[model samples]
Target: MPGRAPAAPRCAALVGPYLSGKTALLESLLFATGAISRKGNAKEGTTVSDSSPEAKARKMSVEMSTASADYLGETWTFIDCPGSVELAQEARNALLVCDVAVVVAEPVVDKALTLGPLFKFLDDNQIPHILFINKMDQAEHTVREILEALQAVSSRPLVLRQVPIRVPGKDGDDVTGYVDLISERAYKYHPGQESDLIKMPEEILPREQEARTAMLEKLADFDDHLMEELLSDAVPPKEEIYQLLSKDLADDLIVPVMLGAAEKDAGVHRLLKALRHDVPGPEVVAKRLGLDGKDASAVIFKTSNQQHSGKLSLARIFGGKIADGATLNGQRIAGVLKMKGHAGEKVPAGNPGEVVALGRLEQAKTGDVLTASGKTPSGYKWPDPLRPLFALAIDVENRNDEVKLTAALAKLCEDDPSLSFGHDPDTHELLLYGQGEVHLNIAFDRLKNRFNLPVKHRRPSISYRETIRGQLKQHARFKRQSGGHGQFADVHVEIWPVQRGTGFEFHDRVVGGSVPRTFIGSVEEGIRDYLVRGPLGFPVVDVAAALFDGQYHSVDSSDMAFKTAARMAMQEAMPKCNPVLLEPIYAVEVAAPNEFTARCHNLITGRRGQILNFGAKDGWPGWDMVEALLPQSELHDMIIELRSLTLGVGNFAYRFDHLQELTGRLADKVVEQRQAAAAH
Candidate 1:
C-alpha cells in the first residue's frame, strides 16, 4: 500500500438552474454514500453545501461547495455548484475540472428551455454529462413528456436509463419505483433507506420493453456490433449492454437520463452506482485537454478567501503527485487541504484526479495551469468566461475606505472572474460589472460581510457629447493686472461643426504674428480645455477652432495669457453657435431561441431602437440573432427584461457605434438634468 499508486479519484459537478434541487441532490448523495450519518435540509440551513452565511440567509447556494466521499473502496469528490444563473461562472469553471457533470433539473416542461445554455456548453466542449430529473414525485407531466421537452434543447440524444412506475392517486400520479432499462431489474423506493429489489411488474412489461429497446437503438448508433445484433433480431447480453452504455457515456455521445426525488433519497444510489461505472477518469480528461503527461501539473479552477486560512486555491491534479510544501511554478505550497463543506483537513499529498485545496497559492488564480516545468503547453485552451450582462456604478460610502475597498474589490474579482470593476473616465465613477442585479447584490454583500467595507451603487451615467449646428466668429480679450506684469491677450476664432466623429481640430491661421508663433500651442491647449465642459454642460466634439486674428502685449502676453484669452473666446462663441446634444448609439446583437425572436424585436422597438436585421445565428441551430441600433441609456437593465421575455436564456453583445442628435422632450429633460447637476 505504501508503494502502490493510489486509485485515481473521480470528480463530478452538480449544476442546474436555480431551485432545481442541486443542493438537495448533493445531500442525498452524501447520505446514500454513508459520508454523513444523517442528511441535512437546505431550508433549515443545515446542508453541507449551502453552509455560507449569505446562502443560509438567502436559502440558496451562492457559490461552489466541495465534499468528498468514499464508496466501495473508491474515493470520489463532489462539487456542489450554485443553481442561480447569476452564479453560473462558478459552475462553468467547476465543469472544466470535473470528469463529468450531473445537470439536475425539475420536471416542469416549460422550464426545459432554461437548460439550453448549459446543454450547448457541454456539447461544444465535449464534456461528458448526464441529466438527473429531480423532484420526480411532484412532477406535473409524465417522463416521456419531460424527455421530449428536454431533448428539444439538447444537441445529443437523450437516452432514458430508467422507467418510473406510477399509480393513480387523489392528488396526482405518485411515482413509487423505476425499472432499469439496461438490466431489466425493478426496485421499490423507501424514503431515507435503501430501496428493496422487487419482481418486475407484469402491468408495465410492455412499456419496459419499449424503453429498453429505445435505449439499445440509441446506443446502436455508435456500436456496429450492437446494430448488427439488433438487425438480426438477437438479444444483446446484459454485460454487453452495460459496457456499451459506459463507453458511449464516457465518449459524450449520448445523455443518459435518470429519475429521482432528492428530498426522499430515491434513485440516488442507482445514480451514484452508474457514475462509478461510467464516469471517465483523470487520464481521459487529461488526454482530451492535451496536457503534458510527463510533468507534474494541475489546473486551478477556483479560489476562495478563508477566515482563518488566507487564500485557498482549489485545483485538480492532472499528472504527478504533489505533497505539502511542494514547490510549483516558483511558489511554495503553504498547505494541502481536503475540503469538507466550509472546513478543511490537512492532507500530506494529493495525487492525479483528486480535487484538493492548495493553501496560499496567492499568485495562482482561476483557470491558470500549474506545471512543474514552469511553463504551459502550447495552445492550451482554458474555458472562456462568459461576457458580463449587467453593470453598476459603485463608490465607497466613506472616503477613508477607498483604499480598503480597492483591495477588497481586487480580491473579490480574483475569487469570481466573472465579476469585474473599474473606473469610468468620462463619468468619473467606479463601475462594477457582473451577470445581473442579483449578482451585483451578492457581491455587495460579500464586500460588507467578508471585507467589512460598505459601499453604495447606482446605475452608470451615460456619456453624452456636445457639438454645434451653426457657425459663429467671435473675439475676446483677457487683461489682468495683479501687481507686476499685466496680462493682455486678444484672439478672434471661428467655431463650426465638422463631419461626425472628426473630434476637436484647431487651426493656426494667424498671419504676420498677429497672435505670436511662440504662444500658438498654448492657445490650442486652452481651446482643448474649454471643450472639456461645453455650453451644454457636456464634452464638445466634431468642432474646429481657428485663430485668424488677435492682439497681444509684448511683455505681459505669455503662454498663460494667450491660453486664458483662447478659453475666453471659445466660452463667448459656443453658446451662440447653436449647440446640440448628442447621445451615444450602440450596435447591439440580441441572441435567443427562435421562438422568442419576435418578442426580442418588440423589446428593441419599445426601447426606441432601430432594427438592422434578424436571422439565424451562425453555428447555433434553433437560435436567432437580431441586430439593432439602440440608445445607450435604454441598454441599461435590458438584459433583465430580455431574460424575462426569453425564459432566462437571452443575452446580447454591444459596442459603441456612433453618436445621434437628440431633440424633443427627451433632449430637453437631459439638458435640464445636466444643468441641475452643474448647479449642484
Candidate 2:
C-alpha cells in the first residue's frame, strides 16, 4: 500500500460577489501549486479561466472554468466560477460537486451585505466553505472590523486564523506580513517568493493573544473536551486545535477566515497549505452525496461545445473508475480528457472523486448521474435552476439562418440550465428568459460569437384582453341573391356581459327549431370566431351569446349560410354592447433584506400596485416578503428596478391574478396602440 497511487483528487470552487478578485486568486493558487509557470492578470485578459471571447470583451467571468493542479504529488482541481450575481447559476452548480468553496471578498464593511445570498446557500446545503479576504495590502478597514461585518450575514461561527502585521516604514499603514494565531508564529511576506519567518513582535503580543483566545472560545463551544480544558485553564496543543478546526469545517459548523493579496501572490502560499491539509477527500464528499464508493458512477455537472472537438461533458466520478471507451448511461465514452482551462489532455481513466471531461457524450446533460451499468443513482437531489427574472424577444437577423439559430439556441440552453427560450403564444415572438439583463446579453453574445448566429433582440409584447361593459341585442340577415342560387339566413341573438374570468360562453334556446339542428353548431362556431378579435382590437373575455330566434331557408340555409348570418348578428351587436379593454393583474411576492422593504413598497405603488400584505419571509432571516397586486405591463422591468434598490439581492415571483377593466385615457391609448399594431 505504500507505493499505491494516490486517492482520487479533491476539488475546490472559488466563489464570491462580482469584482471580488476571485479570478486573480485562482491564478495565484495555480501558480503556488506549480501548475502554471507564470501568473496571468485578469484585467489584461491573460488569465486561463476567462478565455472566452465574451469574457475577454467584458473582462469578467460569465461561466465556470475548470483547472487542475498537482500539489505535493496529489491531484487537486480548482474550479473558478463567475462572481456576478446575474451569472450565479454557474457558481451554484460548480459548488455542488466541490469539496469546499473559497468565498473571496474585499475588506469593506458595506460589501458584506452583498454576500448574504451566497452565505445562505452554503449554509442551507450544509457545504463546507472558508472566507479569504483578498487585497489586504489595499485594505481600507481593519481585519477585526471586516470580520465583524461579515459575521452578521453568515450563520456559522467565524474563526480568525491569522492577524495582519502592518509595516511601519510604508507611506501609509500597509499589511506586509501576518501572525498565525494558532501557532503564535510570525512571518514577513515577499511578493512572488517564499515568506521568511520572523521574530514575534513584542508590541502586537497582546492583540495576538486576544484574537487567539476568541478563536479558541468559538471552537470550544462545539467541543466538550476543549471546553473543559479551557475552563480548567489548560492550554490546548496546536495539533488538537488544527484537528478540531478541520473537523468543524468539514461538518459545516464553522468558517475559517484567512487573509491574502492575490495580485502580489502574498499570503497565497499559506492559504494553499491550509487547503491541502484541511480540505475533505473523495471519501467524505462521496458519502455526503449519498453514493456508495465501490460502484463506478459519475455525475455530469457541466457541458461545453468545443470548436475543434464537438460536445464535452465535464463530470465528477463519485465511485470506482471510468476508463476510456467505458459505457455509462448507455453511451460509450469516446474519450477521457483532463482539463486545465481551455486546454485538455487525453487521459486513460478517471477514478473516484476526479473531475474529467468525457468526450462526445451527446446524450449526457448537466445534473445527470450516470453509472457503468447505465442505471441512475436513486434519491439523489440535484439543485434546481433558479427561476428566470428577465426576458427578451429575439430572432435571427438573416431569415435563411433561422433553422441553424434554433439548433444553436438548444445547445446553449443545454449548456446552461438557467437559459431558456420559447415562443410567446399570444405575441408570436421568440422570448429568451434568463436571470437578468446581463445574463441575456451574454446569451445573445454567445449566439453571435460561439454559434455564428446573428440575432436581433427586443422587448416582448404584452397580452391584453377586451371585454364588454354593457349589454345589447341586435338582428341581421345574410341575404345574397344571384341569378341561379341565393344565400338567405336570419337570426336573433341575445348578448350580455358575464363575470370576470368566466370566459366566453355560447347557448342555444331554439325550442321551435327556428334554427335547424344541423345549423345550431355552425351558428355557435361563427360567434366564437367573432370573439377572437373584438371591436376593441383584443381577444374577448367574460361575455356570453345566446341564439334565441333564427330562420333558415330550406333551399339555401346550409351550415355555411347559418354561420355567416350568426357572424353578421354578432358584428351588429358588439359595438352597441360598449366594449372595454381589460389589462392583466398579477399577484406579486417580493423578497428583500429588511432595510429595503420600504423601497420595495414604493416601487410597487409607483407602478399602480395595490399592497396586500408584508411580513418576515419564511426560512430566510432578516429578510421580508411584501405581497402586492401589480399590472402585468408594470412587471417587465420590475426585476431590474428591484435589484437596483436592494443591492442586487432582491427578487420577486408573480402569477396572473385577475383581469381589471382599463378605461378612460389608458383604455383609449391601449386601443389606439392595438389598432396601429394590427395595421402593421
Candidate 3:
C-alpha cells in the first residue's frame, strides 16, 4: 500500500439504510478512484467494506471501514458505515471526525423514511450535508416527483442543484448527462469513465437554461445582489451563484440535492468537488464547541483493539495543533495516523479539522477531549446511546476463560457506546444489553472473532425480591444438651413492613436487663444474615424486626446460641406477616408501523403489561409508542414475537420501570428456582 495516501485527503462518510447501496457506493468510489482495479457489488459479496467474515456471511456492514483514494489531486478519505439501526453507532462516530455528510437516499418514497433519524442527527449537530439522490439510472419516479418526496420530509431547505439529463430514445438504462445549476453548463458522460467534463449541451439548451435561471433565483434569495438582479429580470452571473452557495452551505442554510448512480460512479467526482470546496471543517465544529482554534484540543472518535498496539484511539484534532509523541490529558500516546479505509500512515503533526489517530492511548476514551501541552480540554460530548432493546445472560464456555471473557467484553463495550454490561442483581445473571437482537448477535460474533472470547448466551432470568406487608411477633428457643455444656437461648421478636424499598431493618429492644448487651449484638447479626434470603428464597427487603426480650444461660449461651434463636424467630415471624413476591417492572416503549400498532398493543396486553399510554415518535413508519409496565420476565419473548409480527420492522426498549406484584404463575417459577438453588 505504498504511495496509497495522496497529499490532499478529504474524509467523507457513506451512510444510508441497509441495501440502499452504501457498500456498493463505496465499491464504486474505490474503483473510480483507482484504489481497486475492478468493482465489487454487495450482492456479489466482494465489496471492501464487507470484507469481514461476519459481514460477508451476513451481507451487511458490521462496523465502519476507512479507505483512501487519490481523486483530482486530493486524497479522499471515505468511511463506509452500516445502514442498519443496530450498527448506526459506527456511522454516527464516523461523522464526528469527518467534515462532510453525503446523505444517500433512493428515488422511491417508501425507502426515504429510513433517512429520517440520520438527517435529524446531522441537523442537530449543524453538520454540512448534501443529498445524493442515488439510483437515478433506474428511478421509478420523475426527477420532480423524487424532489418533492424528499422536500416534504426534509427539516431543512433541500434545494436542487443538479438536474439529470434523460437519455433520448433510450430505455433510461443510463444517465447520459446532467446540468449544474451553479455553472449553467451541461456535463455529458464520457464512455469508459465515471464522469463527464463540463460542456454546453446542444440538444437541450433553452429548457436547461430556463431551469438554470430558476436555480439562480433560489440561490439569489440568500444573496442581496442576486436577489436584486432577479427582481430586475436579469440573470445572475454563474460565478455569483456559486459564490453564494459556499456561504449558504457552511451555514447549513441550504442542502443541495444532486443525482448519481453509484454503480456507474457517475456523480462521485462532483460530490468530491463539493466536499473539497463547499463543506466546512474542524474550524466550524470547534467554534460551536466554544474551543479557541489556536488552542490544542482533539476528540477520540473510535477505539479499536490491536494485537500488540493495545488500544488504538482514532481521533480528529478539532482546535490548535498536536504533535506526535505529545502528552495529552496526562498520558503519552503513539504517533498520529492520517486514516484511509484499508490503510493509514503516521503523521508528524495535525491541526484543527484534521482527522488523525493516536495509537495506544492508555487513558483516552471515545468522546474524551484531549488538549496539547498548554491548551485546556473541553466541549466534546459523546452521543447518548440508544436504549438497550435486548438482553441475554452470558456465561464463559470454559471456567478458565471466565476472567478473560469479562475483560474482553468490557473492552468491546468501551469501543461501542450502545452496549451495556452488568450483573442483574436480583437474578444474579451476568447480562449484556444492546440495541436489538441482531445488534447483540453481531457483538457476540465480533467478540469471538476479534478477541477469541467465546461465550454462551441465554435469556436472562427475571430479578425478584421478597417483602412483607403486615406485623407479627413470635418467640424462638434453641436449647440443646451436648457433652461440654447445654446451649440455651430464648428470644421474642416483632417484625413489620416498612415503606416499599426500605430494605431489611433490625433493632434490639432488650430492656429491663432482660438480655445481656453482648448477646443482643449477636442476635442482630444473626437476623441480618437470615434476611439475605426469605421463605421464597429472595433477598428479603422492606421489613423491620426488633428483639423485644431474651434469656440466655450464663454458663453455655454464646453468639451461636443467640444466632440460632434469632434465625428461628425470623422463620416463625416473617411468613406470618404475609410475605409476597416483588418483580422488577420495566417501562417498555414499542414503535412500529401503524398497521402493526394494534398487534403490538395486543402483544403488550398478553404479556401482563399495563398500558400506561400511547403516542407517536419520529422516523418510524407511522410509529406508535406504546407505554406499558411490563415485568422483566415476559419481555424477552415479547420482543421476539413483536419482531416477528412486524417482519423485523418493530423496535422497542425498556428500563427499570418499577417493582410490581408478582402473585401468579410467574411467582411460582421464582419459588421453584429458589428451592432448586437452595438444594444445590
Give me the candidate number with maximum lDDT.
1
| Local accuracy of candidate 3 as per-residue lDDT tens digits, 29-107 | 7777788898876766677777766797788888888776777676566888888877778888888667677888888
Candidate with maximal TM-score: 1
Q: Each prediction's Cα RMSD?
A: 2.3, 2.1, 4.4
TM-score of 3: 0.87
Alpha carbon lDDT of each predicted model: 0.90, 0.88, 0.76
Estimate the TM-score of every prediction: 0.98, 0.97, 0.87
lDDT of 1: 0.90
For model 2, how does the per-residue alpha-carbon lDDT over 1-680 read when each residue is reduced to its tens digit? 01233445889999999988999998988888888999997779899899888899899999999999987678888999998888888998888888999999999998888989999999888789999999998898899899999998888998999999987555678898999988889988988876789999888898899999999999999999999999999999988898899889999999999998999988888887777777787666667666665553887889987556789999988877889999888999999998888789999998777899999999989988888777665656787898888898998999999888888888998899999999988778999999999999998898888888879999887789988878877787998888876888898998999999999899898888888889889999989888889998888899999998988888977777888888888888888888888999999999999999999999999999999999999988889999999998899888999999998899899888999988899889888988998899
Tens-place lDDT per residue, model 1, 10-43, is 9999999999999999999998888888899999
Model 1 alpha-carbon miss at residue 119, Å: 0.4
Which ten contiguous residues of candidate 1 have the minimum total lDDT? Answer: 1-10
Model 3 clashes, total count: 6
RMSD of 3: 4.4
